[model samples]
Target: MNAISPVAHPAPSDEIDLIALVQSLWRQRLLIGLVTLLTGVLAAAYAFIVTPEYQVQSVLRPALIKDLDGLNRTGVYKLTPAQAMQRVGAALDSYERRLEFFRANQGLFEALREPGRSLEQTFESFNRDAFKMLQPDPKKTDNLSAFVGIQLTYPADINGVALVNGLVEFALASERERIAADLATLVKNRLHHLDLQIAAARASYDASKEAKIAALLEADSLKRAKLQDELKALRQQLRTRRDNRVAQLDEAIRIAKSLGIGKPTTPSALGEGERASQGSVIRTEVNNQQIPLYFMGSEALEAERNALLQRRSDDFTEPRIAEIAKELQLLAQNRQVEVLNKRENEDLFLKDLATWREEAARLRNLQFEVAGLKLVSVDQVAVDPLKPIKPKRALILALGLVLGGMLGVFIALLRNMARRIPKTANSAY
Candidate 1:
């Protein structure tokens, strides 16, 4: 058997290595102890000294409001829930944009700029991240909402409560603009559609009325003309033949009388039409000619339709349209409000667009006005900055210790492996 040299040992695994490991470690135990003790103390010092950040919380509660349309009071929405939420969420993002409005706006920033403390510096000092929340210490949660959150955060030195309140107001204003803009779009679209329907109805109604009146007047004029022609022809023949002439006149007179008029003792046209002009007749060689005219609705029927259309009888009929149109004599007095509204729908088709655009502009203005904003307290003073939130220090220290111990145990296992040696002569040094 060859004598083994310690430094030349074969791959260390076959021989039991416990005693060697104990001896080796005992030789370096002081170094190992020192390293462990220093590591532990360093960890303890780390827990003690690193700036303990205490998080102050402010919550952002989503606002609930009447529907955007304002017409739909009940929550059953025509828009999908996802869409509504998205639209509202977009508006909220716009509101968040205002966070930069007050402080970041050039004018405000310039105004805030001081020789020693610039706007940038002031901003750095005045505002802070709005939340560093305690992990759900079940004690912090209430039953009303699933949300366990605090949206606002500030440094322990900053005014937390006041800051929270300020953010709330900004959030409210943001919500209002969003609702208004979205609602305006829906309302404008609905109004435009209704306007179109009313216009079409009015056009058809008037056209039908004019046509009926034309037919009735034409009939009345023809009836009057025939009677006149018969009377004139019989009269002409009467001069040539006396006794027969008298009989002919009598027959002619009877015919004229049948049309709700007396014979021409005074010789006037029969009132057989809606208008006097419609009853005009011309005597031709063979007979009389009459032109038909448009028919008018009954007073009651016209009145009812007018009311439904928000039209005045005087507007379409003879009297009122003339009187009121004096102020606006140049414009077509015949145009109805419903018709104008229809044109807005048909020609411009911008009702919804204009509405939403205006709302967006209005919101944009508000957002700008709210820029460079600082959240100050609404009703109360900021609590002392010295009161830092509890940081769960003990828990942190415990985690550090466990991790350090694990590392130590792993090193010991590696040390034990290094002590193993093979039993064969070939493995000897």
Candidate 2:
């Protein structure tokens, strides 16, 4: 209890005093108002001073030649009308062609460049600002209908309409030329291949014909030799039989003389009686001997000769040989037919190649006549736009007013908190 006489209590430092805070802010209301007004003025000035951007746009429809009616009558190109239209549409929508066009006219963007800006930077800026878009038209129903639409956007200050039209023309022409050249080259190559094939086919046909002829000749020679050998063997057998018959008859006469049958006594006795008696006795001996004799009759000999001749003829005109000959004939006919077909095909290809050449020449001439190419028709050409597209002054000023009011309130609260903290520190000391 030594110094417990009177203890002084310190105020709570962490408690929020709402009434005091309100009073402090009220005192600094003038400063807050001044800062808010100044911020609003600055925002308004910025909105008015900044340069606004403007845009010019145009709508285009692909003006491609459909059905190739002009060229179709000549039968030069094989593409159908639908195919032709598709090709044109594809060329129009090609990004590569668009890029090529952009690069080609990159120098045209130099006029839009500011001082101290590099050409590359200017080109990049121009590219970012420009736009090209393609879309299918909703109104068209046909598959081959020319209903595609193209829109191009550019800065309002430049002559963007003419530039876009020029680029479209150039791209279309280049694509056409490229397609024609490719087709012509293809036809030429095919024709050359067909020529080579025809030559090879002709050679093959000739070789086959010669081989068949040689085979037929060899077969005929073999048949003739075989027939001759058979005939010679038959002739030799006949000669041997005839010689044996003569020998047998001579033996029979010798035997009759030995037996003293019909013997002649004197030379005068060699008359009719002796001859008759000798012939009768010789006949009797021939009957008694029982010898087998071969008597070749005139008719039989003639028949054998006829049979040999017939066999010789049959050898030459064998059925197998006839069949082979028939086959060879058919083969020759087929080869001839094949060659004829090839010739016909070659003629057709030649005609097709000629047509391709004519078409290519026509396209070349057409390109020369029309200096630049045109892919599309400008539906609505871009005109000079008067209104700027950027910098909404009213919107910016409204946002600035709201933000400035909030910041002023935050500053007033911070100052009040700062003064309160010092007072609390002094009371603690």
Candidate 3:
């Protein structure tokens, strides 16, 4: 058998050769450089030709105490500086409010519209990307005061400063109007309540007056009844006294007729003759002397009896009768009750009437000059930017150079590998 020679084997195609790759890369260095240069030029063109966007910001802080004096003095609505700042911030952040501003001033946003896009779509995009509300981060140590800001990123050609400033003013005016309207409503309600209270007071006063009048009338009636009863009792007493006197006079007349006495006779005249005969002994003791009615002659008794029988009215006999008549006449009409009934404006005498009216008047005349009232203080107004925020030329150029180098190296590696595949196939054959 002939000795077999060891055949030489070619390197495996899967194995990489570092020296060959390096040589291939050096040979294509011009192509890589060309690609990088092209990319750099393209990036520069983009940086220069593209529309630039500028950022404008308006900062707001708490309003001064004196600035909100007019609003606070009203007393109906009390607002603090922090609360006011919050309200302004809320207004600025409101989407509906933004849309309202946009519709009212359509000319300001004309530049935002693009061809083949509806105004609504353009606004949606602008609202989503351009408008931003800024607040101090709670985690930041430098945040010492409460603040709010409205930031807008807009095209350089547009008047971004004016737009931001206008938006801020619009938000402030809206909040002011809302506050004023709310205060007005509250005041109106308060006035209405006070009017109701006044009406109630008047009604109560009238009721009291009426009750007093009724009491007076009742008292007068009772007084008149009492006087009438007294007058009747007095008349009866006078009549009884007159009848008893007539009976006594009749009896005395009969006794005088029996004694055969025709004229008036006194006991003293009959005793005078006896006392003259029995004189000389003086008695110190005194006794009540009694006189008999029959001593008056029958003619005198008959005449007095006739006069008593002929009497028609016993009113003159009793002085109390006249007094009672006068009192009854006086009580017939209660002057106090009559005067109270005739009063026209009972409210004038009502309790707390003056206080209620005064309060209502004060509410009606209250002044709240919301236009001059400051809800928020502007710490920084929107100003034109010195340069565009977007289209950073240096950064773009650097990124382009890096990306172009990577792409060129990838293409060079692919071409070198493709060129080695044919050589490997020929050696195998």
Candidate 4:
């Protein structure tokens, strides 16, 4: 083997030299420089010619009015305006419930979906025309309500103020509307009743006066009281008469004894208390003619006593007091029956009157309750925005350019980086 030197070879991609490349670029400097100048100029021209947009921003806070317990307007027990607004907001949110709120917001959907209507119009019409934004949003909201913003864009030499003003009109034009149904309040009612009480009262009033009935009752009571009084007096008179009769009988016996008709000691009349003095308990012995003769005088006195008893029986025979007492008792029973009847009739009337009063009171209370349900306001904000917010064109263009530039550089580098490697060899002689 002859002594031969080995050779190293460079890859095709690496064969490019800095000096040659500079010479080639110098030779094409005019075209290269022109291309760069043209690119920059075109970019400047495009940027300058791009549309300029004016934006309006609206900050919307839900309208909130403070309302107290639906009864007080300005009392201590009232909810704050913010709280009421929150409640309204919640209710508004509940509008999403399709079945329940239709009664309250009737025709609202129709108004919102009106032809040629704007998104803001539909949302703004939630409370119908009762609501209006003092300051509108600058951009279109990406919500179901679709509240919109107004923006104006102008070309390089175009007037921005006019464009923005026109855009604003377009955005604000043709408002969507919904019907307002919150004016009517919720209420519960019960049926009214007053006739029953009135009827009962009238019936009672009719029963209070009756000619025969009054007379019969009065007469019966008077007869009973009079009979009772008379019985009491007769008892006292009878006692006095009995005492006088006893005395008279004793005197008569003395007179009889003087005339030799009976024993002087014999009592012609005697009360139970005076029986011992009158020999009421004495027993006479019998069996001898002489003994009969001796007590003959006592027997005559005893006969006198029997005759007095007969007279006393005749004098006191009529028990008129007993008869009167019986009649009085009958009258009293009749009076009690009448009184019970009267109570039954009067109670019916009283019940009627009570019912009437209760019904009247109930009506009055209902009226009061209705009066108490005063209309209170919830929070509603009035927008007074001085600036417009819309059209983030600058930001959009910047993002677009960055994305385009990254894509351009990545594609250029990918094309230059080849997958295969080159090989070199030296010839043998």
Q: Which ranges in model 2 have alpha carbons more than 4 Å from their true place?
A: 1-51, 54-96, 111-171, 227-389, 392-394, 404-429
C-alpha lDDT values of all predictions? 0.44, 0.57, 0.87, 0.42
Worst 10 residues of 2 by lDDT: 290-299
Ranking by TM-score: 3, 2, 1, 4
Instruction: Say which candidate scores most in lDDT.
Output: 3
lDDT tens string, model 2, 1-429? Answer: 587666687666687778888888789998788778888998899888876555555445545464244444333345554454456556656766666665677655545779987755665666655655555566876654444434555544566656666565655677668756765665556556655665666566666656865666667566656655555555555555545544554453454345343332322232336333434342322234432221322333344445544442332423455555555454444444445445543434332445544555554444222223343455655556566555778888988887888778889999988887788777776
How large is the C-alpha RMSD of every model relative to the true structure? 22.7, 10.6, 4.6, 14.2
Q: What is the lDDT of residue 290 in candidate 4?
A: 31
Q: TM-score per candidate, in order? A: 0.40, 0.50, 0.79, 0.36
Better of 1 and 2 by lDDT: 2
Could you tell which candidate, 1 or 3, scores higher by lDDT?
Answer: 3
State the lDDT of candidate 3 residue by residue for 1-429, as single tens digits: 999998998666686889988999999999888888888888888988899989999999998888887788877788998899999999999988888888877888988878998767878889999999999888774535579999999987678898899999999999989998999999999999988998888788878888998888888898888888898888888899999999998889999899776687675453444335565764453338666777888998899899989999899988888999999988978889888988888778888889888888889999878887789889999988898889998999898889888888888989998998898888886
In terms of lDDT, the poorest run of 10 residues in model 1 is 291-300
What TM-score does prediction 3 earn? Answer: 0.79
Error of 3 at 263 (Å): 10
**lDDT for predicted candidate 3 compared with the true structure:** 0.87
